[model samples]
Target: MDIWKNIIIDKHFWAFYYYCKRLGDKIWFQKLDDNRANLYLIKNGK
Candidate 1:
């Protein structure tokens, strides 16, 4: 019901996946960025 879930499930939504030479590095970077954004949301009590 949330916006994130809607985006994930929407037929109009298209997820783009990239192929990186170093998958571990990309995963780490993605997780770091996601965690930082989530931290901000939590701090703001979103």
Candidate 2:
């Protein structure tokens, strides 16, 4: 959970978030942002 929060708060994440937002890709952006929720899965290589 802490790692997930860290990822979401990362500067690169926000940069990508805004880029997708500016491109009118709310759904895609949301999906990408949602990836931050799966940090444990990622860290564990699941």
Output the number of the TM-score-best candidate. Answer: 2
lDDT of 2 by residue, 1-46 (tens): 3545555466766676566556653233333455453322222111
**Clashes by residue pair, model 1:** none
Q: Please provide, for model 1 over 1-46, each residue's C-alpha lDDT reduced to its tens digit, 9 standing for 90 to 100.
A: 3434322232222222222222323321121232342211101111
Q: Candidate 2, residue 40: CA error in Å?
A: 14
Candidate 2 ranges with C-alpha deviation above 4 Å: 1-7, 29-46
lDDT of each: 0.25, 0.46
Q: Candidate 1, 22: how far from true, in Å?
A: 23
**Which RMSD values do the candidates have, in order?**
11.6, 11.0
TM-score of each: 0.14, 0.39
